[model samples]
Target: MHEMSIAEGILDVALDTLRQHDASVIHSVQLDLGLMSGVEPDSLLFCWEAVTKGTAAEGSRIEINTIPIEGKCLDCDKTFPVENYKFICPYCDSHFVQTIGGRELQVTSMDID
Candidate 1:
């Protein structure tokens, strides 16, 4: 699954950073996850435990900071939540909407030992 790959990548980066500093453990990881990123929190949580089973990140807390789905309406000049992934602007009934946020997946920080 893609979540596995994502978890692996996160672990890889954490491991690399720890190795550089000769650190032996990772206490926590902070992640910024967006609603539009199409990631299931439960799935990611499950993968985190499995991926970190034997690594320095084992037992590390995965903190997910969720980002809201925001969009800018082209016709109404208003910004609102993108419900159901629809691009239509509710106020103006226009289909032209620019996504303003909520499509991000990134590692915000890590607590290393």
Candidate 2:
């Protein structure tokens, strides 16, 4: 699964940071994953733990902040929740809309020492 690669990449970055900062241990890693990011939190966590192995984050925790699917309707000029993969405007029932959020997959920060 892609979550495995994503988890590996995240761990690569975290491990590199730990080495650079001379961190003694990593307490946790927090991720800001959106509804449309297409990444599974459980799968990512599982992969994270599996890849950690003997690394500094071997026993670290992963906290996911799930963002809802929210977008702006271009036709209706209103903000509404988006369902599934359709980008329709809820108010005007138009299929054209601008997504404001809910497609994020970034590492905001982490707890380390």
Name the best candidate (by lDDT): 1
**lDDT per residue, candidate 2, 1-113, as tens digits?**
99999988888888778888988687898889999898988899999989888988889998999988888887778998787868888678897788888988877788889
lDDT of each: 0.91, 0.86
Badly placed stretches (over 4 Å) of model 1 are: 83-86
Local lDDT at 92 for model 2: 83
lDDT (tens digit, per residue) of candidate 1 on 7-99: 898899889989998999999989999998888889998999999998889999889999988999988899988888898888898998999
After superposition, candidate 2 runs with Cα above 4 Å error: 83-86
Q: Against the hidden true structure, what lDDT does model 1 obtain?
A: 0.91
